[model samples]
Each structure stands twice: as structure tokens, then as C-alpha cells.
Target: MEGAPPAKKMKTERQFDFSKCARRKVALMFAYLGWDYDGLVVQADSDNTIEEYIFHALEKTKLIESREACGWTRCGRTDKGVSAFRQVASLIVRSNLKEGPGVFWPEGTNAANWKETTQEIDFCQALNGVLPKEVRVLAWSVVPEDFSARFNCTQRVYKYFFARGQLNVDAMIAGSRLLIGEHDFRNFCRIDKNKARLETSYVRTIVNVTLEPSKWSCDTASGSSAYDMLELTVVGSSFLWHQIRCIVAVLLAIGSGRESPEVISQLLDINTHPRRPQYGMASETPLCLFDCSYDGVNLEWTWQPRALNATIVHLQKIWVDLQTKANMVRRMLGDLEELPGASGDSNGMTDYLYCGPPAKNYIPLLQRPTCDGLEDKREKRNAKQNGAPQTLLTESL
Candidate 1:
């Protein structure tokens, strides 16, 4: 006994049980930094996604028994490195609500009893406390049992920000205005049957699209003094894969004067130019899922003043570090600009990145290179299935 190791005291983790608590179908609003996430959905390969982290916090807080049992429905499946400000999801969660002398109320009882809860769970604080700083549970709502976050969502708003880079903001604004109203956006979006079985319709309504200067535009030092960050906000009933990015890419091309503003009209007329021309998409880092609108859901938020302050402080630290690095780059760029024969007016200020080629290289839209359009795709598929000759890209064009 004397030589034996001291009697080990077994350690226990704090456990919160929800077996008897009233459960309700609730929708939670989330905001996250997408730069580090592999998107909002949970996948087999990585637990680093926003959904994975959120579910982890939910489990730790004893809010749900399992992800499968929660009836999870995400509003959108944003691609990797895409951020969300008001992303929403519906799921069954443990509630502090009480009912008429029932601990585990009848299993088939009405799911709308979430309102009976005496006090709403302080989800923002509880989940934010456990989740990584990049992901935050902003608010939660008591939604209808029939609610489906994906199906019920009415509209989605997106914002993209970029420097002007000698861009024609007025022309960009004009180009965006052409996107208003319902149109078959097939030319604006690539055909992807996997993302949507309804690609045959290829139609979406754009409620509004506007370009405006960001708040920091008044700050002269912002963005190398050429232009501050300008944002393009688009509201739509729904969007296809890379749709917004593709639209933004075209707008940028027009802004750079490589393409005429009338090109938007030409692109919108699917009857004329059935295929999309070759072009690059805009960067993803500046695109954000600004909000998703639903008709009935009204989220009630609980603030964590103390925790929020700490978060603000952390953000300031990050901003400061980034500002330092940015200043160094700015100084280095200034030094390079002053180098002999490196006049700031290099190449007579010809465009570099956004444009495709020299002004002469810009051929008429009718003759420009084209990708497979609807008809061409159908031909290829039929050919592939029927052992017929596949349509060539040149023939399709």
C-alpha cells in the first residue's frame, strides 16, 4: 500500500442533459469568417467547417441529441472561403420552455410549443463562448414546425467590394441596372445539373443591383489614393453556382472599358448569344452572403455585452496587425514606383489584370469565343448516350 501510487481520483466532465427538457424546432442566425472555413456544410473530410463548429458547440451545450435527429436544414450551401453575415438554419433544439406538468411531453406533441419556454436560451453567449472566434451565433428564432430554411427563404442579398482600379463606376452602375427583373440567367451562369436539377429553367429574379462607394471612401489614404473600396450589392430570389461572381466579372470588364456597357444587353439576350464567352470570375474573398430573408421567421437576439467587448478587442488587434503589413506594402510600392524608368505611367496606363487583350483583340460579341450552350450540351449528351459523333466546340461556337 505504501509503494502503490496514491489512490487516483477519477475526473468527470460537466454534463448537461436534455432528455426531459422541452424541445422545439428553432432557427438560428449565424455570422462567420469564411476565409478559413471549407464552407457552411459538414463534410466527411474536415471538421473545420462552420457547420461542424456550430454543431460541436450545440452538443457541448446539450442543445441537441444528435445532428441527424435535429432535422437540420441550412439556408444556403456557400462554397469554400465564402462568408455569411446572416446565414440561417432550422433544427430541433432543447428549450427552457415548460408545458402543463409534462417533463417529456407526448412524443408526437405539437412542435410549436417553443413559445411556452419561460426564458429563451442565451444562445449567442453560450454558443459563441464555445465556438471559435471566426464563427458566432448571432441570434435564434422560434420557427414554425413546417419551416424549412432552404425552401422558405424568399430572397438572398450579396455584397462584393473591390478597388476602382481606373474603373468606370458610372458604366458599372449602368451595367448593373440592366440586371433588374426576371430573366433566364443561363448566359450569366454555367450549366450545373448537380447544384440544381432546375437548371433547365435557368431563370432568376434580380430585385435590385446597385454600386456605391464604401464608408471609407472619404478617407483619402484608402486604397492607394486611386479609389476606395466600392461595393456592389445584389438582391435576388435565387442564384446559381458562381452566378454573382460571373456577373461581377462582366461588370469589371465593362468598367475597365475592355467591353462596352451594351455587352450586358447582348449577354442577357440568350436567343442571340446562346453561349457564355470565356472570362475570369471575380475574387471570392470580398464576396459576402449579406442576408437571407424569410417571410415568417423573426429572430430574437440575446446580447453578451462582456463577451462582445472582448471580441471587439480581439478584432482591433487583428486590424492593427493587418494595417501594419499594409503600410509596409504601400511604402514598398511607393519606392518601386520611384525607381528609374519605372514611371507610374508605365505602358501609357494600359489595363493589366481584368482585360482580356488589347483593344484590337476585342472582337465582335457574335464572333467571340464561346463555351457550350444549352443546345450544344444537349447535342453532346445525346451523342455520348447514342454513340454518335460528339459536337465539337468550334461547331458549337
Candidate 2:
């Protein structure tokens, strides 16, 4: 202890003075591998959210003075273990330009020659420098002050990936086609009684739904396409909670011949089936928020070459790492299958995507137990909030 050298002091980095810089409302295009994050939203109970990391990076880089003052808005909120390729958010951030669209200069600044100014701050590079590698800011554009990332979004596209393990692609396609127009999707979503009113509309417009071969190829060393990847692409104006996962669950049932494609239409018929039948939603790991489109907003994304190159490199590293692990697992599986008297037929669908344990005697969807209808759920929630006697409501029922 006596011979130990004096402990080194941690250097304190100086904070940036945001008051000296101009501020502008900018829209950021970003992506995240959300497997490790709690979710995209910041929660009071957890600090491991994607948005938490993002706001931390923004503040650390002095992109904004504070999260509260930044007026941040996100395009969509992704659940835990879900990923996004082209998620967008708009926020007011510090800027270098003295005069430009959405730019707010500090009081008493010289209003002279703005065209001769230096280029704006490279937001992608700045944020990526401090943010986790899983999350990357791809590009940014100056937007009008009133522009909203959520409200102005014209369309949201989601993609769910799955293996072709004994699934009837044609049947799944037919079922998905039934979801491509406006309909009451109450039966296909988890209702949040705390937030939704009894009279809240369950209607949503789906622009398109298509199933296609995945761009990512599968390993074919065994000369079997059973494990070939496929993608279910859904484009819509908006979605309800757990809607995509529920839809995929029903499609999985139809693809496996457990239910007919007409089951979709039956679920959509709220007049006949007012309550949602109890069914497990599909796994969330393979779901992705593929893209968000803003038709009315004029957003010209500016990508810095260095930032773009860094992002590509980072993504390549992730791909190589995951692919290597996957290949190793596949090799192990093949070796196990070659053993003496090994049954080569395993339930691949259950192995890849979880939709609940297999029922020994599968019950039809219409014959299953159902959840409380909207009005009943609302009454229960209201009773709880109003501190009314639960027994009285039960007696009335």
C-alpha cells in the first residue's frame, strides 16, 4: 500500500455552451438493432431504451441543451427485440448556420451574407461518435418548424421474416391479402384499456400486404430449401398495438393448415366475433420497422461520406459476427442429424418462431376462449379508476 503510486484523477470534459450556437429543427434518419434494448421509448423505470441512449448522445454532443427543450418526436415506437432499418425522428438541435430554413439565431446576431457560411454540423458523425454501435444516425435534413415525424408520416412499412419450414406460402399470401384494406382490427391487436376509450375506433387502413422470398439467402449445403427465408411486407397508414404480431400468428396457423385462409375474414367480422379469441402472438425478434414514408414533407437527407462509410463498416461487422454464429449452429444441427437412427424430421416452425406451445388437441380459433370486449374492458378499467366496488360490477354483470 505504501509503495502504490498516487491514483490518477479522471479528466473532466468541458461542456459545450449551447447558447452561443444557432438552433434548427432537423429530421434524423436512423437505424437500430433492437435485440439488446428494452424498447425504442424512454421509460421511467429503465434507462436501457434506444431513445434513452439517443438523447444521452445528443446531450453529450451538445446537439441540444436538454431533452425537454429539444422538442423531440419519433416516427414509430418499436417493441423490445424488434429492429428498424429506416426509423426517423425530428428534433430541434444546435446548428452552425446563422441563417437557414428552421434556423433560429441568437438575439442580436448580424443578419449579413448567409450564402458564404460554412456547411452545417455533421449530425450523423457527431451522434454516432458517442452513441452505442447498435444505434446509428444515418442522415439528417433541416425541416420546417411545424413538421412532425409522427403526424406527417404518410406510411409505415413493417417486415416479418420467417423460414419456409413446411408452411403453405400460397395460403399465407391469401390470408395476408385479406388484411390489405381498411377494417376493424380489434381482434388482431391487444387493447390498452388504460389509454383507449370505449368508443375508440379500431379501424385502420392497410395499403398493401405481400409475402415474398427474402433477399437474405439461406445456407443450401444440404440441398433443401425448407429453411429458405421469406418476408411478409405490410404497408399501412398506422397500426394498433401487437397488430402485426397477431396477424402473423393467424397467417402462421393458415400456412400450417391448422386454419383456413377464411379465418382472417372471420376475425375481421366484429359483428359476429366481438371479443378477440385468446391466441398467442408471433415472436417479435424477426419483426422490423422497415421504412417510414413522408410524402408531404420535403426532406432532403444529407449524408456525410465518412459517416456513411463508418455505418456500412459497422453493419458489415455485425453481419459477419451473426452469420458466423448462425453457420456454426447450423453445422452442429447437421452433425446431430447424421447420428445413428436420428429422426431427421424436427418441428422447424416451432423451433424458429414461437407462437405458444403446441396444443395436443388444437382447437379452432372460433371455438377458443375470448378476451373481454371493448365495452367490458373499458367498464372494468373505469371501475378500477373510480375506486368502485368490484363485486357490484360483477353482480350487475
Identify the leading candidate in terms of TM-score: 2
Candidate 1 colliding pairs, count: 1
Q: Which runs in model 1 stand beyond 4 Å of their true positions?
A: 1-17, 100-119, 193-200, 217-219, 222-224, 301-311, 334-342, 345-366, 378-397
lDDT of 2 by residue, 235-327 (tens): 998998889989998998898889999999999999999888888888999999999999987999998999999999999999999989978
Give per-residue CA lDDT, model 1, range 64-107, as digits (tens): 87888889998888878888888888888876766422123437
Clashes in model 1: which pairs?
Answer: 97-117
Off by over 4 Å in 2: 1-15, 106-117, 197-199, 384-397
Whole-model Cα lDDT of every candidate shown, in order: 0.74, 0.87
RMSD list, candidates in order: 4.7, 3.3
Worst 10 residues of 1 by lDDT: 346-355
